[model samples]
Target: MINSTQVSYFILVAYFDTGALKYLYFMIVMSLYMLIVGANLLLIVVICLNRSLHEPMYLFLCSLFVNELYGSTGLFPFLLLQILSDIHTVSAPFCYLQIFCVHFYGSVQFFTLGVMSYDRYLAICHPLQYHIRMTSSKVAILTAFIWLYSVLATVVMMSLSVPLQRCGNTIEKVYCDNYSIVKLACSDTTVSNIFGLVYIFTVIFGLVILILYTYMRILKVCFSGSKQTRQKAVSTCTPHLASLLSFAFGSFFEIVQGRFNMSRVPIMFRIFLSLYWLTCQPLFTPVLYGLNMSKIRIISKILYLGRRM
Candidate 1:
């Protein structure tokens, strides 16, 4: 149970001054939110309906899309409301729930990406073993483990955060982020900070390095294969690799910038980084998987034509 002080609600300070800017911000963010929700939901539905997309890679991608939808929703809707209205306050219980969902879903996504990297590694480097190793049952079990791990990790993090006192309940950002939430705590957060650093290194950084290494080995093996086989393999992987690079490198640089207290950087740069993390995950998740899937592309085209008609 969270202490009363720790459970205190927060009021986010909106950035807009003019009523016109507020309205514009509301419309833009609301539109983006709806787009993210609709696109991800559509992708999930299409993937489930199409038997051709039942492979482990598509399965992992679908899981990632779902996580992005949940992760973004945890904060976006409330923040959108705050942007439009003068009231930026959130209830204490709701705030903690938001924190839990954000962390849990985000971690699940990281794990799913790790799973995707391994799937690609097997498909590219060990084509003979891919079928045996990534059977439907094994994929299902791996996905289950990812979700369970995410839940356990979230429990530990949420428990650590529950003791902080939030007497002055004001946050600078548009959303309830971990750094901002931890900063307001009256209790000593030294242990939490240390734990966060450890978690970041072990889970986030370590997984990223492992993914890169696996991909490199896969690439080497792919290049050594017959030309036709190599071309086919590259076609299957190149898009996913590009998407991963955009996601990982962009996030890494932006996080380093923000963590180093580079907030004094241009407002446009700050907003770009904020929206990059906010929008790209949802936007690219569906697009990457959909593009890689010919069946999905045909279905999307049919849907678009129907809408137009």
Candidate 2:
């Protein structure tokens, strides 16, 4: 029986045995990674430099962009290295680190979205009190709480897994996840599994429910209001909803893929599904927000034209 202390590395068996196409796979992943970084950084930079965007909403968006970068960085660099190398092994410490970062990204993301939804709710439903309700200090505190809460949650999850007696060093995924790591434990993982499920439901589903309730209220207020008010509400809320749905789809698919036997699914499709959230959400967010938000679009145009000049 092997223990956690004896395990030095985990072999990842999720890569495609692409034979001659490995180079192609590498190039594709590299390209996507570059795009994700570039898009996210651009959003972050634009938000930072533009004085007009230094509000609670843009500040939250900046945090979201940064989270996207953090999440992708945790996975992409390691994945790229694995693609070029023959060995798919990751050191246990690094695996746990990756687990922390990826999960932190997810938790922070949902929390940030929840904050954004609440921001919208206040701005739309309680227009007169919006400024007082979402003051800069309050927003800053909320953002800090989002990050710190995520870190605490991830730390607890990782700490729970560290004491388990690991029997195997093989993970069947391209990246490290808590579930995959816990599944390798030799001893009973009932506590970890139960806690994990409860954590997921309480965090992810709780945020989802909060978002739904907030949006529902916003919708109700929009319907009872005037034409211009409806347009304003829709314009402001569309990007948030789009981002929410995009993330939800990716998360849902990844969870389903992880929990079920996907043997019948085509290998390429399976791979895509597994990585869809990490790859797509980071790219989807900036593009959706930059294009949909009029102020952001205008600022982006100015930046583009300035670079051209």
Please, what are the lDDT tens digits per residue for candidate 2 over residues 1-309?
Answer: 889999999999877566878889889889999999999998899999999999888999999999999999998999889998888899999999999988899889989989999999999999999999999999999999999999999998888997799889888888898888887888988888888889868877788788989999999998999999999998888988999888888889988987888888887787788788887889889988888888888988899999999
Q: Against the hidden true structure, what lDDT does model 1 obtain?
A: 0.76
Model 1: residue 86 alpha-carbon error in angstroms: 1.5
Point out where model 1 deviates above 4 Å: 1-7, 302-309
Give the runs in model 2 whose Cα sits over 4 Å from its true position.
Answer: none
Which pairs of residues collide in candidate 2?
A: none
Clashing pairs in 1: none
Error of 1 at 223 (Å): 2.8
Best model per lDDT: 2
Candidate 1 lDDT score at position 176: 62
Model 1 Cα lDDT, one tens digit per residue, 1-309: 344465557776535455778778778878888888999999888778778878888788788888888877876787677777767678777877877886686678778877788888888888899989999999999999999999998888878876676556776656665666777777788888888899988888888888989888877877777887778677777767766776776567546753667557775576566556657777776777677767788977877797899
Question: How far off is residue 44 in model 2, in Å?
Answer: 1.0
TM-score of each: 0.88, 0.95
